[model samples]
Target: MTTVTKNKVTDLFLENAPSFGSFLSLREESKQIVNEKGLPAAKDEEYKFTSVSKKLEQVITDFSTAKPIAVSKDTIKDHLWAGFEGSYLVFNNGIFSKELSAFENSGFGVQMLSESNAIALGSIAKAEKDPFIALNTIYFEDGIQISIPRGKKVDSPILFLFFNQANEGQIISPRILIEVAENAEATFLEHSISLDEAVYFSNSVTEIKVGQNSHVHYSRLQNDGSKAIVVSNFETDIHRDATFTSTVVSLSGDLVRNNLSLRLQDSGCVGNMYGLYLLNGKTHVDNHTNVDHTKPHAESNELYKGILTDQSRGVFNGKIFVRQDAQKTNAFQQNNNILLSEDAIVNTKPQLEIWADDVKCSHGCTTGQLDEEALFYLQARGIDKMQAKGLLLYAFAGEVLEHINDESFRNYIDGLVQERLGSNF
Candidate 1:
């Protein structure tokens, strides 16, 4: 008989779990879940392609104490987007930094999670199902709740900047809850960065609720350093006549895994997702998305693209489910990849499970190198090989970048993408 021993990292998480919170019972329950399930191993179906737990074990030796290093305002200023006139909420090492954060009177309500009586904090994200989410629920130090009042349209965007400066190996979990009331609209940007080349594991969770007749646009940028490992879960519930759109741009990281789940709870709801991951070196990025349509007259669209060079790897698994009651549903999903090196690899799977016969659902995936004829045509011109390759790759990534709605944010992300592609044009 063989007896399995629990990983020390899990024990560290259990030992350092927060004891006080309004959601103490929920946190306790999550702690129990984590204790029983532990972290997902390579044998797990959902995480087979990416071994997140093993990778964490390699880099993180201790999680009992978080050593927070001071980051200057000049350092923060260097990362802020130029011409972005919105509110800035800074999180230093996964804890909300009130002194470093600045707010604009955008008419939205902002409250600390530890002090607010938010009933929907744990309603959208289910920790019982995912161990990473369970870890986040157990170890999150502090978070924020943003509420948009009913019938209000916010003009400026809200940027949540997370700067990690842990000297020793540590575990950082950042939690966020957003609520958009009926007939309201808002945009949010979540950006993650590492101030120094520190070894750390960041597990983050964000839950959003879109009320009836409301619209929400969310964008996430992950540009952590090469020594950082990150796992993030983004879950949202869309109500009747609501629209929700999310764009995730992953540029660099040691090991990054993104789980995005969208649930359409009522009729006439729409959900759209777009993702772009450009990787080099030995970095690994895995994106898993699930879109659930539970009612009639709902729609969903998803498109994810990847460009990998050197020895980097990419994985994408997207699933769409239409229940029996979800008649007249429309869902489409596609994942495309371009491998720029002989050693680069990508694994893509697009799935659709529809129980309703009246629904229109389809999914497809493609993985290949750049078009040789097009490259030859460009080389036939005055463009060199590297420049021509960069141009082609940039054009390949533009399909996903075009879906971003905000002009300023889109332009900033465009510049980042261009830099990654090494294309000056």
Candidate 2:
């Protein structure tokens, strides 16, 4: 087994190693991390419920020999929003697709990295700490560098679309880094979708820096093909008086894992995290979030909800840390799950670690089925059984959706939620 796995890693390395000369040192560092940690095992506390290493190994074996699928401009034209007035940064199978991107009418500063520049300053610490992130840094072909000038708020939201077309099973790694200057504001919307019949792997990493007094809002949609396996990370650094918020909606995927982390480096920072996962058909999703309050008077809030049916499974783990000197820190976290089927499973854990004496912190976790009485009330209102259930579930899922400020995007997601609830009826 050891020999087979070693050869598999070698095969991938030979095929995907970066040709960008300046990244040699950084690649070596990331490779060392991958070699030391490999993939997280079931026994690893952080990955106890999701033992994905074995599954990832199997997919990678196929990735080593798979053929590149065809990607045409027309194939993805329908995926973009009509009359979109903002710029777009697109990636197909983890590589930049110039033919499909729109950079002509961009309002904010947008630049593509020169191999040397992206590697020298990209988020390398996360790669050194996590194997999935390490794999991305070593093999990523190209990445985008987005700069929002000080005091300038973008007129429209920027869209970062990652569309995968894997005719044969393969591995796709997408890397992105964004910097918002002091007093600047911007909104980024990301959509990851698979339009192929093959089972692929998507290992994506995004690093965002919110400068002092800046504001950043991000919304991510993970609706990959049913057989796709995904491991992604969204890490942000919050500077003094900066605010950051993110909303993640996971509607589909076979084995999905997401890590959302925020670090409050200076005083008066505020961070918000919200997510909702609707699962069915043996799907599995795991979300792990961490917020570090390192300075005084910082605040962080997180709420994640899940709805599981059939034999689907979901996991949520949230952690908030307040340093000793982070006096007046305010942190709150909550996780709620509803198992719509008897065979469904959900594991939720909320944690708080505070070293400061004068701070307010709270955490809560809950898992339950639909409210029987409420369902009955809806049924008594002349609604059929399936319709009543859909109504209740729709309301349950709307809490997180309501936070979206984009009308068109929110309505688009609302239609998906409605379709999801009306399934199997």
Candidate 3:
């Protein structure tokens, strides 16, 4: 047998990263964190259920080189939504593609990170807490910064398309920073997809700042190829009277981990989070969320659901923090899962840490199979077993899907969910 050299993933990435750039100081700081903490292992409490680093090492042999793949306009059109009239930004293999992107109006300001001076780039989603975030800060080639002017309401949603087509095993990191001014309203959609079957790892970070009296709606769809390994971090800060809502849908991937953090900085801020993960084959998906209530009168709600089949596995850990001064805070979190196969498994934990006595905070989780009585009742109505199962599962997922505000995008996601379930609801 030939001798194979093994190296740490952090070392491999550091060796391939550039030593000079405008973000040199920030990158160096992140580099030191990565070198010191490295990727989370099984011993890490936060990542005990998922081994994303080991999965990366098994599929990725060369992290330094990326094979050139041409993506034509027609290729992009194939993936576009049928009736989407909103603005769109495209990223090809972690690099922003201006030629392929389209802006329908000047309602919002967009700038490339390399060309703009973004003071809030590393503010919300600090890299020191997570190794994946640190790696993204170190490896990201280009990113986008979006700003919504004060008092402006964007009529159409903004869609971010992250497409990856790599022949060799490489790492792809995409970064996004969005700032919404006071009294502004905007919606954003993030979709990540892979066109090839190559083994590649994706580490992405997104930070959003919601200004006072503003409302922001954000959604993310992760539908990558079977050989893809993905780790994503999303952090947002909500100011006084601002409202933030986010929905994350994980459909397919070999291994996927999502970390979401929301901070309510002032009174009257509201944060809402919803997530759905449908897994089959040997896929593993982990979702971790944190909602912090710092000021009084703030509110937060979180709900995440998962359906696992075959030998797939799912993990959900959600936490709510009510600080000492966060009186009159109303925070709730829940995670529910349904396992369809005997070999499938799910681990769910919902926690609440309250330092204030006046706060109304509660968290709970449940994991079990589909209700046999409900299935039987559906079968008794002359519905086939498969169709009954599909309808039941669809109903289970509908609660989360209904939160999606855009009708067109909601229908699109509904169709994808039906297709994955192999039946219409």
Residue-by-residue lDDT tens digits, candidate 1, 106-208: 7798888988987887789999868999888888877899899999999888889999967667888889999999999998988898888888889999999
Report the C-alpha lDDT of model 3 over 1-425, residue by residue, as the tens digit.
23122236656766677554678888989887777777787778999999877777677776753433577788778888877778889888887888988884758999999889988989899999788898898888879999999999998889999888765678788899999999999999888879977788888999999999999999888999988989999999999999999999999889999999999999999999999999998889999999999999999999999999999999998989999999999998999999889999999889889999997788888888889999999899899888888888999999999988777788899999988886422
How much is the lDDT of residue 424 in candidate 3? 20
Model 2 lDDT tens row, 108-213:
7655655325542456237766777777777676667777888888868888888786645666877778888899988888888787646887888888889999
User: Which regions in candidate 3 have their CA more than 4 angstroms from the true location?
Assistant: 1-7, 65-68, 423-425
**Superposition TM-score, candidate 2 onto the true structure:** 0.93
Q: Write down the TM-score for model 1.
A: 0.96
The reply for model 2, stretches above 4 Å from the true place, is 1-20, 63-69, 81-85
2 versus 3: better TM-score goes to: 3
RMSD (CA, angstroms), candidate 1:
2.2
lDDT of each: 0.88, 0.80, 0.88
Model 1: lowest-lDDT 10 consecutive positions? 1-10
